[model samples]
Structure formats: C-alpha cells, structure tokens
Target: MARIKPQALLQQSKKKKGPARISVSTIILFSLIVVLAVFFLHSTYRYWSQRSRIQIEDKESVFKGDDSFLDSKKSDLPGYAVLETAKGSITVELFKDSSPEVVDQFLDLCQRGHFNGMLFRHVIKHYVIQAGDSDKLGAAEDWTSKGKNYNRLYTSLKHEAFMLGTSKTKHDNGAFEIFITTAPIPDLNEKLTVFGKIVKGEDIVQEIEEVDTDEHYRPKSSIAIRRVTLKQSI
Candidate 1:
C-alpha cells in the first residue's frame, strides 16, 4: 500500500458525517403528548365509573323509602297487615311506599282471600318460617301463570328479624309466597323483596319458630294462616 499524506487524511476525516442530535424542544413535545394521552384515558375512566355508581344509587333510591332500620315506628308506616294464623296474630307494617308493587300485590291477595288457610310448609328453628306454598295447595300452575315476572327489585331494606319477604321464585305481578325471618339474614337482603315487617307479633313469630320441624325443615304440626286483614295507615 502507498503511504497516505497527512493533509489527505485530514480532508477525508472532515468529509465523514457524525450522528445527528435531537433538539430538547422535540423531546419535550413528545413527552407532553404521552402525558396528555395518559391523563385523558384516566379522566375518561373516572367519568364512566362515577356515572355508573350514580345510576345504581338513583335506581336504589326509588325503593329506599323513609325507613332504614328494622325498628320502624308504626305511626310512620304506610299501612298495616294483620295475619291471623293458627298459632296467633302477626301484625306487620307494610312498606307500601318502598315496595309499592309488592305491597299492592299482597293487599290484593288479602282482599281476594287467597292467603287464607294457607299452610306454613317451610319452617326452621332460629331461621325462618315460610308459608303460602301454592304448590302444596295444588294451585302452582294457576298462581305461576297469572302474573308477569317482576325480575328482582333492589331495595334498601334488609332481611332483619321479623321482616316479611316473598319467595325468590315468585316475584311477579300477583300473589307471592311469604316468609318471616326469625333472625338477621344478610345473604337474602337483595335477593328477596321485603314488603312488610312484623311490628306486634314478635312473640308469635318466636312461637312459630319454636315449632318442631322434620328433616325437610317443615313443621310437624299443621300451621295455617286463617285470615289476613289490611288496615290503612292513619
């Protein structure tokens, strides 16, 4: 190889290009765009979350009514229902405003005498006492077919002791089977509709709870609802 000259090497070095450098303004602009995109996504998510929560709260407010606890005063109640059973009388305060559809259905059934003489088929000690089994009375087909399905009514009412609720399967626009809680049933709070609460028949409910039950949680002796009378609120 021939010897290269210093002046020629210097000229070749000067002709070679170096890596290009990015300006600080371009980098800052890119970073700002990324930050704005993340902030926009976060804000959108928060807006939708708050909107969904507000919708649920609004829906529940319709059934929240005035009472929130179990010990509601009789004078503040919307109506009253007296269940004359074989054991004793159970006076229940109807949540007419909170559960208008359910209360109306119950009142209609009482007026039509559909719950009269209905036997208490399901009973459990320190749990619940359930009655109005249309199947046992040979009227399941008639009862199930007469009403439109009400789906589920989400209410603020809880399944406190002496709370009267209808069967989970029969939430329709007609008569529904009834049950009274002997204890606080939290698992059934939103699952069942609470139409009324026992105001004057705690002892009677306790008496019914004490009745002997068989292996199927059914009362050994026949317990019947002789009549149900409705009274308007004063």
Candidate 2:
C-alpha cells in the first residue's frame, strides 16, 4: 500500500469527523419526530374517549315515567303531560286518551325532564319539528349520563292527523320527539298520529317555521324544549 500524504491524512480525518457531526443532528431529529408522534397519538386517544356515543336504548324504560335524571329531592315527582318548546313555546296537549300506552310512556319521560334542553331535530318549515331524542347529547362525565343510549320502540299507528314522527322513536315512544304541522298537510290526513295540538303559541311556531333550517331539519338556532308539564286543563 502507498504511504498516505499529510493532505490525504487530513482529508480522511475530516471525513470521519463529518459523520459524527451528522449523527448528533440525525439523533435529535429522530427524537423530535418520536415525541411529536407520541403526542399526536395521545391526543387522538383522548378525543375518542371523550367523544359521546349515545345508544338510545339504555335509559330505564317504564311505560309510566322514570325520574332518573332528577336529584333525590325530586325523585318521586310525577311526569308532565304538556310539552313546552322553548324556541316556539308551543303547548302540546297530549292525547293520552287515544293512546294511553304510548302517551303514558311519553308523559313519564317528560316528567323526568328528559326533554329539557333537547332539540327539535326534525323541523319542517311551516310544518312541524319532531323534537324528542336523547342520543344526540355528548358523552361528558359531568352531565347526567344514562350509561348508554336508549331509544323507544316505534308505535304501530301510522302518521295520522295531528300526529308527529321522529327518528328517535325507532322503538317505542321517544322522550323528546315532536312534529309541528306545516299546513293542513292534507296528505297526512289519516297517516300521522295527531296526539296533541298547540293550545297557544301558534305565532311562535310560525316564527320558528320561518327560521333557517338545515337538510336534517335542524334549526339554525338551537330550538330547545325547556320542560314539559302535565296539566289537567289547558
């Protein structure tokens, strides 16, 4: 082998030193990448855990009504028969007489304040907003959670006059489902069930009809049902 010159020896040393210098930067870059990936994964997992997954088939199903959401002080309170929508304050006079089984079941849910702050998810302008559903709420530990989602069975009765419909009632009478009539809706004459009518607040209902609505019937503003109360007289 030929003897190395001074300049060649220096060049070899420089080459050796260059890799060591690059190694430190490469290690730092790899560590930073690993840290960022770990943080991203943790964030994703936390988001999924906190996200709500209401099943709508987990609430205590009592045909009468159950006071699960209320506190111990109001445990024995009875269910309400009247539903007061906050966006339109329309008073629905439930026809518990026609369909006692379904009405009683719904009344019990109303009394429990199940419909409170619930949105009228299905609002047809000049028609109706079917507003009872518990599955839409987020899964937050702070809020009153029903363990899982609970939905009622679908009623056998077809959509007759004065009747309403809801996606919430895939099973029985849903707690927060309602539909405000658009017009006579003559086509729904004997189809939808007219369980109740707006004793007052027709103007409010009209105003709600005028508000911007989405394809899913969701109102631009959250039209909430403050609470439903049962009354002997309208």
Candidate 3:
C-alpha cells in the first residue's frame, strides 16, 4: 500500500522477469541450419543410393547381355551400344521403340562384326559422323560382287524413305549407313534414321568430329571402328 519509487518499481519488474531469452533472429537461424542439415544429409543419401544402384544395374546388364530393362514401352530406359574406335569409346543409347528396324540392323551388324575395321568416311563438324560403308571394308570386291552372305543380306535390307517428322521408323536412305550428329539436325531428321544417340563419351564424339578431313569430308587419317559392343540393362 505504500507508494513505491520509480527506481524501486523498475527493480521489482526486473527481478520478476526471467533471464533474457534467445532473440527471434537466433531462433530463425537455428531453424534454417537444421533444415539445411537435413536437406544435405537427404541429398547425399539419395546421390549415393542412385549411384550404387546404377553400378549394380550396369554390372548385371553386362553379365546378362540382355536389355530387358530397356523395353520399348519404357522410353526413359533405352538400350545402350558401345562403339570402341581408335580415338575412344562412344556409348550410344538406342531408340529401340522409335526405330526398331534400324536398331535391329545396327545390333545385327555389330554382332556380326560388320562395323569392325570400318572407317568414318565422312565427319562434318557439328553435323554428323557418317560410317557403315560396306565398300570401306577390306574385302570391297566381296561386298561389290555380293559374294559374302552377310553382304547380300545387308544389301537386301529395305531402304524406305520416310518423310521427316512423320514416321519414326522409316527414313530417307539410311540403310546400312549410320550417321551420328553432333547437334540436332532437323533437316536430316527425315532424310536419315536416327536409331541411337551418343549418351556417354560425347567428348570422344567431339574429338572424332574435329578430326582432319579430306575435301569430301572424309577423315584423312583412318578413324576406324575397332569394335562395337552392346551394353544394356537386364
């Protein structure tokens, strides 16, 4: 009931209140750190998990020698083919669904060693690397004369000229020739069948693209296809 001085009232108020609490900024900063830590840990876990799964799947695919995992229904997962050239290996993802015949022919040729020792006849920078010339084979006479059974079979494959942006399977005059473009060539879209695309070793593709060429765009130094191996998930 006695009148309290201003100083005494202030002292009483201070004594009644608890210790100073954390600032709102401090609380917000702590929350942010916690969120960031959780996010980083989650991201790291996901990255390693995905990488491990991919390694396992790749190993299995190599051992199995089947690309059942890359069924045509699943456009996301396409069959892979590795072309081991003198320069380096270029792994391509075959669009089996988009151009089944072309893929089939390519695979068949690869299995039969058709592309082996073949030269990259034409390499236009930022355009395409053209190969698969049976004439380039050491035994050109055999190919020309149609003496070899495989050569005859290759010659017999239908060469349908499907319109650009119209049909997925057919193309102008692709036949045994395979053209790997450095960039999107909409002009050649209908003219050539794009069965596969280089997914890995694009640097090697670029290296090949930059190779010295003749007047006809043919590689001056032999850019041979040492071998073609298939790699796909099972």
Task: Name the top TM-score candidate.
Answer: 1
lDDT of 1 by residue, 103-206 (tens): 77787788889998998887766667778755342222222222233223433347467898886565354547887877665455545677888999799989
Better of 1 and 2 by TM-score: 1
Please list the C-alpha lDDT of all candidates, in the order they appear. Answer: 0.74, 0.54, 0.63
Off by over 4 Å in 3: 1-78, 134-175
- On TM-score, the stronger of 2 and 3 is 3
Top-scoring candidate (lDDT): 1
Model 3, residue 6: what's the lDDT?
100
Per-residue lDDT over 1-234 for candidate 2, one digit per residue giving the tens place of the 0 to 100 score:
999899999999888774434578899999999999999999998877665332223332441245444333243333224556665456566655555455655666766777777776655554454565643421111111221221213223342223443222254453435565644443343334455666567676776667786655467787777776776565
Better of 2 and 3 by lDDT: 3
Ranking by TM-score: 1, 3, 2
TM-score of each: 0.55, 0.47, 0.50
Cα displacement (Å) at residue 105, model 1 = 0.6
Error of 3 at 99 (Å): 1.1
Error of 1 at 2 (Å): 99
Name model 2 segments beyond 4 Å from true.
1-81, 134-169, 172-176, 189-191
Q: Work out how many backbone clashes candidate 1 has.
A: 0
